[model samples]
Target: MSLIVQKFGGSSLANMQRVFNVARIVTQTYNQGHSVVVVVSAQGDTTDELLSKAYEINEEPSKREMDVLLSSGEQISMALLAMAIEKLGYHVVSLTGRQAGILTNSRYGSARIKSIETERLFKELDAKNIVIVAGFQGWNKYDDITTLGRGGSDTTAVALAASLHADVCEIYTDVDGVFTADPRIVGNPSKLRDISYDEMLELASLGANVLHNRSVEMAKKYGVKLVVRSSLNDSEGTVVKEVGSVEKMYVRGVARDNDIARIAVIGIEDKPGMAFKLFSLLARERISIDVILQSIGRDDTNDISFTVKKADLQKSLGVIRENLGMLNAKEVKYSENYSKVSVVGAGMVNNPGVASMMFEALYDADINIHMITTSEMKISVLVDVEKAERAVNAIHDKFKLGEINS
Candidate 1:
């Protein structure tokens, strides 16, 4: 029998009826004579509610304790899902991340999985038991409960699939499949039939939110297959594999990230090691940067602008400000009014006019581009957060991405 690893997001298990709905989806796959393993996220708003409760008690709760608290959301989902499967006359068992033998580093709220001991998973699967795993959590080296940050459930599922060598890992969400643009932002965006791992990775990192970027990275590294589909329907989902369709689609999808803040180091010395010293300080603090632009040196000084997630704004500002004199920088300036909009596709590597076309779209839409960055597979532009949605629709329409045969 083929082995399948399935993951359900919070929306799929939001209520009792939805939980049972997920259970039936699992059992139906089992009835087809395949070995099934399921991973699940917290129910609707459970994680948020828990975070609110924690903040109410302590504005700055201990990271270890927060991990412990957040991890419970997935555990509740696993148990309730297991109970539903049992009621459907299926042999089922629930296991937490630790119980399932997932080991991670001691990073508390953003731990990276070190390794997974698959002996327990194999034994349970061999016994014909449907294994339900609590996603987004694992035990660290210090024996402390740790979480894998937001959207970590997707990483958990892919990691499990790689460890078990499952035939396929299906990620069930609220949408039917990956769309050219977020449906809420762009009307009538087309759904991709399939996408390459690299394309999906760029989209995820650029903020498509259909899948996690780390999961896509792992899938690419281990050659694991992924399918993203809706849990509430039987639609054919989007397939993510090593190579996508052979069609010459220059732009496959448009994505917008509103969670970014721009930081500019103003009046920095235009010397050789200044930029290096400035960024190295932020790196030491584990802050990630994106879409960097360096202004031409004038008057022996230059301005460097870059973007970071909004969550890291304060930390990043603190790091830069504290080291301003050391790096020969004058001042640190930041703004939370900017957002990133990107278009991703493998074809962009060999295509010309992609950037100009994207710019043209923005120009037509009366939007201003602040910063730009490009790679072989993607192009990202920063614009006003308030105009981000219009920018996305403009870019998507410029490429005619919504057309079925485009």
Candidate 2:
């Protein structure tokens, strides 16, 4: 019998009926005599509601306390799911992240998992019990509850599957599988049958929300098998592994992220270490920058523009402004009206004209491109948020991504 690790997202367990739906999915696997371990996120909107409640009490709650508050969401899910499995006359045990031996660094709301002690997991499995562990939370060295950032449950599940050396890690969500483009934005985008870890990682980091990027990183590191499918259906889902089946396809998917804001630091002295001094300050503040563009030095000055998540825009500005004199920069300009759209594929490594094709599509759509960046597997462009949807559809059709499965 295979040791299967299954994870259900918040949408899959939104209510009583849905909870039972997930229960049956787990029990069916258990009935087949395979050892089962289940991981779950909070019920739908519970995390948001809890956050609202916390903010109502305090505008800026302590990160430590926020971790304590947010981790409760998954606890509710695990217990209810355990009770549902019990109602089905099956043996099940529910454990919180701490009880299940998930250890993480003390970063509070965005803690990084350190290690997972799998003795308890194996002990429970040895007793023939279906183990249900709370996702998105673990305890730090101080014994305080810590949460992984949003969508961290996917990371939790994959980490467990790696530590346990399970046969396969199945991530069940609302959608059938990973698609070439978000079906909501690009009509009838093709769902991919299989994707490489590198391509999936790019799509996830670029804001395709089907799977968390950290989970893909861990899966690749440990060589764990992964499948993403809809919990509500029995269709075969997308498989993520080292290599994709469609080797000749130059592009695999298109993704858009609307949470980014661009910052421009203008007129820095055209000298060595200027870029390093400017970015090192932001790095110390843990503000991640993306899609950076540096202009050629002119008149003894150069300008650098970069993007960061909207949430970090203010903090990033604060750090730069506080140290403006130290970095010898002239002025800081910022905007929140932009979005990033990207295309990812392993086949892009040996491909040419991919960028030109993308730019041509945007040009035809009359969408203005603000900045551009490229890697071996992906290309990203920043554009007005208002035209982001048109940009996505234009590129999707330009590449005929919808016909991927045909």
Candidate 3:
């Protein structure tokens, strides 16, 4: 029998009715002669509600304790799912991350999977039993419970697929599949039939919520095939696999990040080590900076701009202010008033006029591009938050992203 590992997001099992829906889906797959393993996140808003409860009691909760508290959500889901499957007259076993042999490093909020010894899973599968494993939580060497950061469930699902060598990893979520642009932003955005792992990684990093970045990276490393389909429908969804050749790739797709903010370090002496020193400070504090751009100075001083998550603005700005004297920057300016919009595709490097067309589209709409950063697969531009919607629409239309209406 072929092995298939499927993961369901919180939205997939938001209520009792939804939970039974998931059980039915798994039961149907099992009846079709496939060995099915299911991974599941918490019910809708369970993790968030737990976080709020913890914050109400303590302003600063210990990370280790927080993980212990948060993991309960997935545990609840797994047990409930097993019960539901049993009600459907199927033999089922549910295992937590540790029970399923998901060993991870002790990073508290963002642990990485070290190894997975699935001996028990094999035994269960051999008996024609459907195995249900909780996602987003793992055990470290010290036996301490750790939560993989946000969307870690996606990572867990893919990692398990790699370990089990399953034929495919199905990620069931609310959306039908990965789209050319967020449909809410761009009307009738096209759903890609297939995408390469590298292109998917770029899209996820650039703000596509269809899949998580860590999961994409893991999939690429292990050559795991992934499908992001909807639990609510029978759509085939987007297939993520190896690119046979770099030539067969799309030119551009929409990515928008509203959680990003711009940080401008003003009036720094135009010197080589200056940028290094500023970034070093942020690294020391464990603040992630994305999309950095440096501008030439009119005199001998330059302006350096970077983007960080809006949630980290206060702490990151404080760190910059503390190191201001060492950086020798005249002023540190921060604006939560900006957003990042990117066009991602693996073929971008050899695609002629891609950048020019992107700029021209924005230019035609009179949308000013404040900062720009490019990687092999993607180019991101920063603009005022108010103009983010306009920019996405303009680019989507310029590229003729959806099916052409001839």
Candidate 4:
């Protein structure tokens, strides 16, 4: 039998009953003669609660200490899950990320997986035992614990599947599968049966929470097939692979990101390397930039505006304020009242008028677009946060994404 890697989200194992539910799922897979490796995140809201507690003690908690504290959530999930499997008479062992030989870069909060040592996993799997590994964390060269930030657990599961050469990497989430749009808001979004890696990458990066962007990157690189399914039931889920059946498709999914802020550096020198200098400063601080625009020089000066996550707004502003003179920028202006709406599909790269269709939809809805960015597979626009849902609905309806994906 082939090996399989399954990842359970926090909601899947929120409590003891859910832990037993997960164990039953894992045991069933193992009972069928296939070796099983399970990766799990912290139980429901455990990571958030940990952060709240940390903030209560120290307003600005150090990332290193936060890493130590946050890593405990997954550890708890792993242990309880292992015990649950044992109660069912299955031979099982739980391992933390470090104990499983997951090596990562030194970045405390958003560490990338450097490499995974598979000896420990192989040993346990060969002994006919199910292996449970904590997701989202790893050990750095300095032996300090580090995390992969948002969707880190998804990345962890994908990496493990690739390292162990598992047959499929199943990511169990709250939703049954990937949808044409968020069903909760769109009222009747359709689920996609399959999607390509490129399409999924664009959606994930643009803010589809179904899978993490880096995990898709790793899966594409390692040729690991991924399935997004619901943990609560046995339902057919969407498959993400190198290629899909729908090559003629466009607008596979519509995604929106509300945790966004736009910052404009006004009155910059408008010289060569000026933009580089300012962005380099943010990069040095590990702040991410998205949807950048530079206005034409007016009054012998230019304005550079860019978007970043709302959480990074303060740090980005601090960096800009600190390097204003070096950047030759006069002032920094920022607002957290924006959301990003994007349409993602591989066919967009080959098809024409995708952006025109999206703009037409927004025009009909009377939504004002602040900034626009288009890539080979996607078109993204910034709109008022309050109207983000309406924009997504308009765009989804315009493209008939539900019909095509349905």
Candidate 5:
């Protein structure tokens, strides 16, 4: 029998019926003689609701308190799932991140797991019990509850599988698997049979929303096998690993992220170390930056424009204002009406003209591109938010990705 680690997203266990459904899934796996360890996200919209409550209580609540509040969501899911499994006459135990030996850094709301103490987990597995562990959370060195950032549950499951040396890590979500484009947007986008870690990481990082990039990064590091499947059905999902044997497609899929904002620091002194100092201020606030563009001004000044998640716009703006004079910038401006559309595939690395084809599609669709960035596996462009869906569809059609099947 193989030891298996399974992670279910919130959409998979949103209600009691879904809870029972998930329990049956777990038990069925157990009946097949696989030792099962399940990691689950908080119930449907639980984290969002908790954030709303926290913001209602205080505009800027302490991160520590937020972590405590947010971490409770998964605990509820774990306990209910454990009870559901027990109802089916299976021995089960539910453990919090701490009880399961998950130790993390003291980053509170966005802590990175440092190490996992698997003694307790092994004991329960050895006892022939299906173990239910809360995902996206851990205990820090200060012993404070910490929540991994968004999509952290994926990381949790992958980390657990790596730690336990499980046969494979299965991530169950509402969708069947990773697709060429969001099927809802690009009708009948093809589902990928398999994807490589690097390509998947690029897609996830560029906003695929299937698997968290951090989880994929960790999986790549540890060589953990991961499968993305739908809990509602038994169809084969996507297999993510080191390599795929199929002939590589020019573009595997497209991802569009509308949660983007652009910040422009107008007329900053064009001097050495200015970029570093200015960005350092944002770093101090823990803001992540993306797609930096610097333009030469008429004289000893330049303009630096960059993109960040829309949610971080305010904080990033604040940092800019806080350091405007120090960096000798004329003014700071930002726009929240932009979207990031990306095309990802392993084949793209050795291929040329993909960018031109994407541009051609966008040109045909009359979608205007604002900013651009590229890596070996993907190309990302910023465009008007209103045209984001059109851009994605046009690109998907350009590659005829819908015709390619997993």
Candidate 6:
């Protein structure tokens, strides 16, 4: 029997009926002569509700205690799912993250998996019992409970799949699979049958919520095959593997991220080691940066700008202000009202006209490109928040991605 790791997101198991649906699917996979391991997120808005209660009690909750309280959401779902499977006449065992041997670093909220010990899990599988593990929660080195950061469950599923050497890791979500573009944004975005892990990573970062970026990186590192599919339907979904020469899609998808902020450090003398000194200070403060651009300013000065998550704006700006001597910038300007619009396609790497077309599309719409970043399969541009929707629609239509897909 082959081993398969299946993960269901919160939306896929939002209610008792949905719980029963997951149980049926697990049972079917088990009966098909496969050892099934299922990882599940917290049921529908339960985690959020828990966080709300914690905030009500304490504006600033301890990360350790917060994790302890938040992890219960997935635990409840795991137990209920196990019981549901038992009602369907199958042997099943429910294990929390610690019980399943998910060992992670000591970070309370945003821990990363160091390793996985599946000995107990293998023993249960030997006895032909289906194992259901709570996702998003793991144990620190000291055996204290901790929750991985947002989108932790996806990382959990991919980690488990890597640990078990499963043939494929199936991600069950509300939608059928990864589409050429977000179906909601672009009507009838083509459903991709298969895509490379690189393309999928771009899509995830751009705005595809089907899988998390951290999970995709793990899957890519471990050479694990991942499938994104719908739990409510019998569709085959999309297969994500290493890119192959055989072509199936000219452009895979487009993603737009509205939660973006850009910071510009202007009028710095163009001297050696200037950029390093400024960035090192921000790195020390743990501010994540994306899409950095440096250009020569008028009169021998330089302009450096970068993007960070909107929530980090105050902290990041604070650090820069504190380290102004190190940055040596005449002024630090930031725009909180900015958005990132990205178009992802595998063929962009080979086509010289892709960049030209993208720029022309934005130019035609009179949308200013603040910062630009490109990858083998994706191009992201920053624009004014008010024009974000128009920018996406313009690029989508300019590439004629809609016409090409439908």
Per-residue lDDT of candidate 1, residues 10-127 (tens digit): 9999999999999999999999999999999999999999999999999999999999999999999999999999999999999999999999999889999999999999999999
Model 5 lDDT tens row, 1-406: 8999999999999999999999999999999999999999999999899999999989999999998999999999999999999999999999999999999999877899999999999999999999999999999888889999988899999999999999999999999998888878888788888988988888888878899999999999999999999999998999999986336586788998888899999999887999998888988887899888888986789999999888899989988898788998999999999999999877776788999999999999999988999887789999999999999999988988878753
Structural similarity to truth (TM-score) of each candidate:
0.98, 0.98, 0.96, 0.96, 0.96, 0.95
For model 5, what is the error of residue 170's alpha carbon versus the real structure, in angstroms, after optimal superposition?
Answer: 0.3
lDDT (tens digit, per residue) of candidate 4 on 187-210: 878888999999899889988889
Cα lDDT tens digits, model 2, 19-97, are: 9999999999999989999999999999999999999999999999999999999999999999999999999999999
Give the Å error, residue 124, model 5. 0.8
Model 4 Cα displacement at 65 (Å)?
2.3
lDDT of 5 at 343: 90
Reference-based lDDT, each prediction: 0.94, 0.94, 0.89, 0.92, 0.92, 0.88
Query: What alpha-carbon RMSD in Å does predicted model 2 have with respect to the real structure?
Result: 1.1
Q: How much does candidate 1 score in TM-score?
A: 0.98
Candidate RMSDs in Å, in order, are 1.2, 1.1, 1.7, 1.6, 1.6, 1.8
Q: Which candidate would rank higher by TM-score, 2 or 5?
A: 2
lDDT for 43 in candidate 4 is 100
Q: Lowest-scoring 10 consecutive residues by lDDT in candidate 5? A: 244-253
Off by over 4 Å in 6: 244-250, 403-406
